[model samples]
Target: MSYATALKRAARHNPAWKAASVFKVAVEESGAAVLDASGEFQYDLAEDTYALRDFTQEERFTLHQPYDGDAALTVITANDPNSDHLILWEGQFHKILEVLGADALRGTVRYRVKALPQDEAVPIRHSIIL
Candidate 1:
């Protein structure tokens, strides 16, 4: 079977896939934004670290790592012109920062995204939640 078909089947029958949350994508057209796609994918927070130093003589510091606002998403389809698209996941909007990877044979793509500032985020529509 083709990779896409296999992926579709897995998404339908796999327990892990069934537990994943759905995410919506919006694309701009004619000055209006419209829903372009929706899918279920594995979402995870990307690791981020910060260095904190003591005020004493020695230049010593510790890494204060945490899950930053950024996240990694793996999906079955690619969002073209990613910057122009907004993803609504977990009741919040996120902007795609970059494509991490894509595998045609596997029918999957990975992306790095950061949550949009509240002022810039569009409200999520009830119809798009699914």
Candidate 2:
């Protein structure tokens, strides 16, 4: 039910996701937070991006987009005290949407969309396979 457990489980069941995640490695930031892969919410990340706690190597990659603000990637560079740049896999996550979902940028799916059904209803599919 927790991030560590979920990562472990994914590693156990999904062999493809083993090295793709941080179970085998000694990650500096290991915690819960949703992560999108191939334009899908593949990982169910914890609600708080800055969850008043440590972030694993994976969590630091996502850029948080709240309901009421702009989206930008959060990175703790080598100079920071609490976080280390060594743990940061790369600067590739600077673009939040790209890191979140590669498909999201290529007309596959929209990363953050807020549209309430007014009169007519809109259909939503759980997964998009292209």
Question: Which residue pairs collide in model 2, if any?
Answer: 29-55, 29-56, 30-56, 32-46, 33-45, 33-46, 34-45
Q: Estimate each model's TM-score.
A: 0.46, 0.18
Q: Provide the lowest-lDDT 10-residue window in model 1.
A: 46-55
Q: How accurate is candidate 1 locally (lDDT)?
A: 0.46
| Residue 86 error, candidate 2, Å | 6.0
lDDT of 2 by residue, 1-130 (tens): 5443444444446433212100111222454323334432232111111101112233333458534432322221111112101111121111122223323122111122112225532222221211
Candidate 1, residue 50: how far the Cα is off, in Å: 32
| Candidate 1 backbone clash number | 0
Q: Candidate 2: deviation at residue 72, Å?
A: 16
Q: lDDT of all predictions, in order shown?
A: 0.46, 0.23
Which stretches of model 2 miss by more than 4 angstroms? 1-4, 20-130
Model 1: per-residue Cα lDDT over 1-130, one tens digit each: 7674567566666543322222443334464445424532323222111111112332323479665666666555422324444555445556677766677575655566777676753534443232
